[model samples]
Target: MSETSAGRAPEDAAGPAAPAGPPGAPAATLPYEAIRAIPVRHYGRWAAAVVVVALLGALAYGFSQGKIIWNTVGTKLFDHTVVTGVWHTVLISVCAMAMGLVLGVLFAVMRLSKNPVTGAVAWAYIWFFRGTPVYVQLLMWFNLSLIFQTINLMPFYKNDTVAVMTPFVAALLGLGLNEGAYMAEIVRAGIQSVDPGQTEAAHALGMTGAKTMRRIVLPQAMRVIIPPTGNEFINMLKTSSLVSVVQYSELLRATSDIGISSNAIMEMYFVASVWYLVLTSVFSVGQFYLERRFARGSQRSLPQTPWQKVRTNLTTLRRPKVAR
Candidate 1:
């Protein structure tokens, strides 16, 4: 055969040869082509955002044009009376929450008891308290003196009911007792969420019912209980305003008094709203940390704090992209 034909036959039989590389060098690799991906455009999200911004702008303009006295709001924001009212609000909220927590735990245990009498009693307490409006309860406590003029504890203590049941006391009883009913349900639900096996294991370990509950069950249940309790406490802060009806000089009552005296009623309301926002926001931060503390064993990773979230978002925005 001819030389060209013979060489062509061999090349065809063997298939195409790879391109040669320089001596002592690695084989050449095919060049990489990166894919350019386009992200989806959410026109709906953009439209919603624009609508929200427009609505917010309209609200701001409306408030600006209203007859609200901004000067009065600023002037009274930190007045002695307003500060005192804020103090009272916090004081009452804390006290009431404490009382409610105790009552809730007690009632929850009783409600879960095997004894029929104790369970029935707990059920009735929860039912009645939850059934009634808190406002009505406050009024009832304030006027309790009319039904029973004096409270007698015999050798321990005795006093006129009216004297004993001050506005603060009445408010406390009203808010705390009402809160207990709701908290009992929350606590019960948390307790029920715990595994029955854990309780049985505790029993097998020679722990008494109360010991098992306090040591094993309660500690675990707290993770569930804390979130709702924090929410209840925040709600209690706002609900404390209703105590003003019973003549308790809480934040709302104090603000209203100022409004009446200064004739800047709407402005005073704005001040009260601002203070409420501040107080709730502070408690919300506290609640977040508290929840994080309890989430140690339960979560694979704890949720990011507000500051952490902000930092992560900023970092993402500033990150350098690789050229394709």
Candidate 2:
């Protein structure tokens, strides 16, 4: 009995052994199962996509049934007169924008000046130009000869108002002056957006008012100024169409002439629209790049270009999915 007890004590000290499997069999292990998470189905998003696609299809079908002469549009799209008109439109828009920019900067400075006289003058100029319709201004400019027989600067130059106020000059003044009033407000807003501390710093550095404005403030303010300025320029391009009323041959006027002669007014209108779209799209791309360039110090990461966006999307689409 003593020998049997001693042998049991060793077994007790060792504790209960695990149950054995079949002879020579490997230890059993629970197989690892990865969690298969099912994504939530967005039925609402799918429904919205279907609705949008259906609406687009219906619109396309409707336009397809319209009486648009596509051949006429194609034929006259690149006609010599149409091309010339496009050139003139671009020229006038550029000239007017340049004039507006100069006047805007000048008046914007005046509007912010300490002098009551200068500020009032600037305010009055802006108020009058902004208040009047651009069409009326154009007509007034065109018919200036009726009011003043001559434009005289006795010491330097003098001319008959009719001769000096050609259709081109009249259109330029009308468009440019009106644009300046709008641009002045834009420039002033941009200038004000800059930190007052920046100006104080410039003053501390012994920079004169003019130098500080030109060298320090304007550069910084450009970030705010560029976006709206680009939009205004694009608008100017479209507004140049109104010059046709004054007999200045621009894209719209040229197209109208061709339309009258060819008896395809609607087609010409379509062609003009296409050209305008093309011009606007091209300028839009330029504006995007310009804005990106000015965004350097403001943003840690600049917005991606259209090409970069496309590449990123494609890469995401092509990436391999891990097996569940």
Candidate 3:
């Protein structure tokens, strides 16, 4: 009995244990299964989209088939006067924008200055220009000869105010000065958007204020500044139509001349609208590309192009199905 008990103890000591895995064998892994994708259907959005498309289609059909005189519009679309007017409009917008850019940047800097007098002066300028209606300002500029018959530049020459303040000149001054007031705010906002550390770092490097602004600050601020400036530019293009009130003979004025003479007012206006639409469309495309160019450094992943988006949608739809 003692011998049998001793043998049983040895067997119990070697009791059953977990089976050993092969040397360095990895543990068994579950087969990979992609997460199931569930597409959300926004019924309200789909209904709204359908309604909008229907409305747009109806409007387009009406415009195309309406009893409007397409012949007159076609004849005047490329008229010499219309083309010349477009040129004049372009010239005015370019010059005014240039003037506005210079004054805007200068006033923006002055507005931000630590000097109370400088800041106050800039503030006053912006306030006055922004407060006044652009039409009234244009009229005031057009009649400046009444206030100052002559502008005396003793060292250079004195010119009659009327001679200097032609319709073109008045238009330029009114648009540019008004635009500068708005642009000042835009530039100031852009500069403020930049991280304050950038300015401190510039100072630490012993850089002058002007140098730092030109090299470090403005470059980075451009990404923010460009979008609004483009919007202002496009708006300026449309606003130049107001110069017609002062007889500057811009696109609208020239088109009006033809309409009145030919007694085809509606047709001429339609022609002018078409041209304006074309110009705005061109600028819109340009603005889009410009924004994309400036956005490259800031975004981690750039927005997908139309084609890329289409391809992505196709791939998503074609994703392989797993057995239920």
Candidate 4:
């Protein structure tokens, strides 16, 4: 090795090679822009998407062209009888859901109670309601007078059995109570989703249990709660048809009556399906906005609006190509 004047080696004479460039900078090389951003075209994914779209389009075209009876569907769709049925469906759904929400919150709290008796009662309620078919429950409620000849409430009413158990009352009780059981579980899950630390912090700040729950925990839990609750509402809307078995004139029953009278069975059923689809679509859109509203603190960033997403896609498509 070559020696310096102070007996150092030749590499020592170069003074540690001057570190190339800045400390974290990569080493310089030819084809300086080699680290380029190239859009990856996943041919398999693109092909699959195209195939799925084609299949859906074909199915839609087939459905439109298939001849059962379009005239009957159009005529029955906006009939006064059908419209009345729609209103009844909406009323029952709203009333049942209101009852369910109230009872669900109550039972969920009971289930979480420190008392074993309360917890057991809540558990049994959920178990019995959830275990049985809703159809059976509805049937039993409609025919409840067989078991109870007189429903007596002296202070509240005249102890009359007939007034207490009409088809409407039975339907309401059946739909609402069963829904309460399901909703209880849903609410319990949402409550559990909230961080225990938040509750503890609220306690530390001297808030009452109810106050903390109402102010902090429930607000947070709603992010988890709202989606499933919306789904339940949609399910309830469909489930209202079950009341038709008891001669309640809901949408399906009315449509069925029309079909039987006019001899356009399939067409009237199709009209009911269309109306149901339209209602569900409306609910879905509402649910989406409700979810977005509640997702504020939980999500790191809000989801993009459809228009924003479309604009982004358009910008990407219009981007100038980079030359190799």
Which candidate leads the pack in lDDT? 1
Q: lDDT at 123 for candidate 4?
A: 98
True-vs-predicted CA distance for residue 188, candidate 2, Å: 0.5
Clash pairs detected, candidate 1? none
Q: Write the per-residue lDDT of candidate 1 for residues 91-200, one digit (tens) a residue.
A: 99999999999999999999999999999999999999999999999999999999999999999999999999999999999999999999999999999999999999
Per-candidate Cα RMSD to the true structure, in Å, reads: 6.1, 8.9, 8.5, 6.4
Query: If both were scored by TM-score, which would come out higher, candidate 1 or candidate 4?
Result: 1
lDDT of candidates 1 onward, in order: 0.92, 0.91, 0.88, 0.86
**By lDDT, is 1 or 4 better?**
1
Q: Rank the candidates by lDDT, best first.
A: 1, 2, 3, 4
List residue ranges in candidate 2 displaced over 4 A.
Answer: 1-41, 313-323
Scored by Cα lDDT, where does model 1 land?
Answer: 0.92
Candidate 2, residues 290-309, lDDT tens digits: the string is: 99999998999999999999
Candidate 3 C-alpha lDDT tens digits along 194-280: 998999999999999999899998889889999999999899999999998878998999999999999998898998899889888
Listed in order, each prediction's TM-score against the native is: 0.90, 0.86, 0.82, 0.82
**Leading candidate by TM-score:** 1
By TM-score, the candidates rank as 1, 2, 4, 3
